[model samples]
Target: MPPAEKTAWDLARAATHANLPLLGTPMSQVVDRLLSARIRQNAFKVRPATRAGVMVSGGGYQGKTETVCEIAAVFEDSWRELHGSHPETVPGSRDLWAPVAYVQTPVTAKPKSTCKAILDFYGAPTKGMDLPELIRQVAASLNDHGTKVLVLDDITRLRMHRADDQDTLDLIRAFMSMHVTLVLVGVDIPGSGLLREGRGRGGKSVNGWEPTQTERRFDLVELDRFRYDTDEQITAWTTHLAGIENALRLLDARPGMLTEGRMPEYLFARTNGVVGLLERLIEDGSTEAIVTGTERLTEPLLDSLPLTLADSVGRDVAAGEVPALPAASRQPGTRPGRRRNTSFDDRGSAASTA
Candidate 1:
């Protein structure tokens, strides 16, 4: 092989060893847009009070975390390139300038704890401070360092009606009050009362009126699984397959035979168009081939991989389900395109055979 091909092959082999985030379209573009908007806002001499934040709500395994993390990585890289490798800090202050500050909401979702988490992210002292004091400290620190955006993940876990939930809401309000643009990412929490449409009729707030003031400040972005019933869905699947095929070629491995073949119909059907599930199927299938020294993907290999068919039975389905159609009753050796009545249940997986 040529030296370039040899290098590509080596990199591809290494890629298979790790489960890395795949750069897909809408996901990458949205992250870039959010970051760019934040950067543009940062350039403003006076921060706009009406600057809207973004809320990305999706079901689990939709790459919410991965997408946000990717944004964080990109921001850090861009910041490092603009500033030197060593970030310039505030005069006589220990705070390091950060382009982005990412924190996961605590399980309790208490305002104090969540505030403390923000302070902790900024390396600020969080001991023995009242809620108001802590909030002030955190907001001040973020402003001091000029952090572009604050990303909070798992916002769905905030329990409504609980004092902690109110606290979480307060913490968020404090961030907004400080002119910090928030990038909230979490499972979809519809009718959570904490949010209200800008033009909503009547007074509809999730839990109470406390969140009413902050409710209209969000730009909502909801992500759903891809579909196979339409041309658009097929294009998404095919485009993703092209990316995977390119990856396989880099490994000098045989291209994805399953993707190249009719198996994508089966794949789209099984995974229900969830990017995460598709990624898992590809990752597991690729890793298996590499382990077994196959160096190529096949239908049987792709089919044999135990995939996460559905969720863990909150809405309806069981955890162990393989999520595929019962074998077609068509005569053997007769290939017929089949679309079953089975729909993608966003609730959870069902216990069914592959």
Candidate 2:
């Protein structure tokens, strides 16, 4: 007899399997761009004019958080794999090499708290140091490590009032002036203010180089959920699902049992094209398959499971409807609290919510 068809339980077991690598989605392309730019920047450290940075912005669970880990791993792993020990020299210069430093910006991040996080990351002694002194110490410590890159994740958490945010920006500007390549990742970033045209708080009347300074240092990259109705988006979504199916085959007891077709479409409908939601839906569906002894993930099996969080929003977005803009614009002229923003936090790190 031909082999039995695989059950929902089988796929569920596979979904929960450990060490799953990232599926190659649009976000992967953004990750590549970030790494490539960093490599180029690090390779020509002598040319301060050529020094630059990048910002990765996207909706929540659109892979902003995961991208942080992946980018850090790429920088550190690539260097370590190439050379067995910590780099003794900077990429382009004959200076000591310190690797990339990744820090989660504290919630409502103030300048002092942000600096403290940076200092702690470097193990720099900050005892009794004033803000100015702390900046000097942090810079010196990073310099000693020969650190070439500074990645500030969860940047959305920074307070947006002029006084509060200006301080944080000052710290970041200090790092950029040192020619350190900075990578900022967040979901709340609006394409305005320093991100669009350089203007500080209060409006067009305000003139400052700080916003310009930020724009000059970093280029922008965006990542969001795939759209359900668009053919192009559907192709990408199917492509992602195909990868998962291929991976499942490795553990599949029966060959040709996990073929793809309608499943991905159902998944897109359920997840409304959000990658994170898609993953969660699959996991939940698989778990039920195990519990109920359903053998395979069919339309009925998935429909019986709880709906993904993005179900409604994803569908609307796929149909070309834009969600309400965040109120935290960070643009100089925008009204306070009118600036739309999204939540961001570093994985497994303490945040300064105060």
Candidate 3:
């Protein structure tokens, strides 16, 4: 084979292998065991209206994006892994055989956060020239496929960084009406009046919040914070977190500085166990380390991380910033912030978080 051809083949093979068992999507054991079955069931039950949803609630980090992307990659790459790779030139229409997964994250920094804004993403017919039409075009175009997974990241963005359980729930229901497999990620605790909607208009079954169709074709998967004290699990979710940062850093740029021979122990120590914060911390750490020589990741460098991270970490751990946190728990440079999510150290996996 030509050298370039050989390289492409090798790269494709590597991509296929890394996604085996698809480690990215955070799934409950029940969902994991029945993904294929559930997909098939929904495929048959709802042609224009299938609906399965998962709501992962935790601090802003915890591998949520990693988890979701992995699942998307799984659906995207499964074909090549199962069938031999065709030339990249194959038209996405004629040669495309794998299930196409459409991703629509309507959560943006825009000021309009209304049902019209969201329904637009769902592809509902919109005649007016506005955000709603853009969303509608996106939703319809993406959902046109036979089998697809639509992921809306940070759905809570609609409520301005506040958790609106009703908005979340309503959006999920709306997406269900569209017959799409959905995954929604956001923080816990409702910041909007969405919770009021979920309570149902009195005397209605909570689960009765189903589609108006003849059948129910979806399941619920809830992602929770890793329980720290499970009998089988350890309390130091920090260790697991340390490994995550170390791996990302090692795989990321500046490999030698952070991983060279050892691990990012400080990376783990500082962020505790929040994946979002840990990622930001590591990213900030790597950027600084790369530019600075990183003699060793120190308290001073960590303190200089971006404001988003600083604010995020601060909100999690400070009860009033009483005593300065010990090195093991404190991210450097900054004063004590808010208390963090309790760490989970047991042999606990994401599945255990439920």
Candidate 4:
């Protein structure tokens, strides 16, 4: 191919792989159904009462944030469609009419900073405001914007030992009373001190706060990595891979490039069933395939790529646990060659290897 044509083709392939759609898995489906129902119910309620929220907890790279955000975006789209024109702007004023507000909790979150994050989402000024004032403004903004769902990702960042974090947790609970369905996404929330009761002086509860309130107010759900032990799980995993394979745009790609033979098992071993890691591996492998003129995914090609930090840790944890691929599935003379370091090589040498 000509130089210009090759560059264009390479760019197009990169874009296609980068924007691959989120494949539906059993966990995402369940989260959608549950979160959708809760949001719908909260939106319809006219009476003043605390809305029950959902807490999506899981390990890193389990797609917790992506899944919840997709559901929230879908809800917002349908809501605007149902409300007809001028859905983004209020009828008589320039106020924003947002049905969903998504924000991330600050890494070193305190009660004041947490409230500031919410205010920042609405483009509201929080300067010179104290904690109480910040809280009042946040509530007002939620009402003014007509927000029905508020998503706070990375909720476990709040360390409950500090008084500020304790108050932040309380502030989050207070937001539930504002009639917005709260969707808290975090890693291992149950293990986080957010749910544990604080010990008070003389063994009494601090300020008579009820720790079970969190458990009762929010429906905690977990998103786990895909498992291969059961037949149903195997089907789900392979189906997911097939969806990805179908979306790929390589010139020489063949059907079952990811799902047939030992590829599925090999991929499972590499990613440990984490969707994010699997996508990374596929994307990097595909880019290498295009650069090297192979134009198709293969075991050796994927194996040549390096693992992310998360994947490396997961591999260490699952060492000797993942089942080994059968001997018959291995190709007789195929092995992954070492990736050549071309950063220090001249253009001619790099082109020669390519």
Whose TM-score is greatest here?
A: 4
Give the backbone clash total of model 2: 14
lDDT for each residue of candidate 2 in 117-152, tens digit (9 for 90 to 100) = 888987777788888888887777676776667788
What is candidate 1's CA lDDT for residue 112? 85
In the range 1-354, model 4's lDDT, one tens digit per residue, is 999998988898899998888988998888888999999889889899999999888777778888999999999999888897444355577788889999988877888999999999999999999988999999989988889999998887776678888888888999999979999988777667566634332211454645477768888788888977766887898999999999999989999999887677777767778887788888888889888989999988876777654343323122121222222233332222223235674556334554
Question: What is candidate 1's TM-score against the reference?
Answer: 0.74
Candidate 3: stretches off by over 4 Å: 1-50, 79-143, 157-177, 189-220, 225-242, 245-269, 298-354
Candidate 1, run of 10 with poorest lDDT: 314-323
**Candidate 3 residue-wise lDDT at 348:** 60
Which pairs of residues collide in candidate 4? Answer: none
- lDDT per residue, candidate 3, 88-187, as tens digits? 3334554333244433334332423443444454444545646556545545554443335566555444442334533444445565666555655544
What's every prediction's RMSD, in angstroms?
9.4, 15.1, 12.5, 11.6
Q: What is the lDDT of candidate 2?
A: 0.61
Global lDDT scores for all candidate models: 0.64, 0.61, 0.44, 0.80
- lDDT: worst 10-residue window of model 2: 326-335
TM-score of every candidate = 0.74, 0.70, 0.50, 0.82
**Per-residue lDDT of candidate 1, residues 1-354 (tens digit):** 897986677567767545544666655466568655664564352645645677776666677767777766776687677777344366776657776788887766788889888888888998889988987898788778777678887776665666668667866865876666787776754544456422232333443444455556776666555556666657777777767666653233555554655666666654666777777777777778766767676667776776754454432112111234333222322223444444553767777897
Q: Which stretches of candidate 1 lie over 4 Å from their true place?
A: 1-21, 27-35, 42-50, 79-89, 196-211, 249-258, 308-354
In candidate 2, position 39 carries an lDDT of 55
How far off is model 2, as Cα RMSD? 15.1
lDDT (0-100) at residue 260 of candidate 4? 86
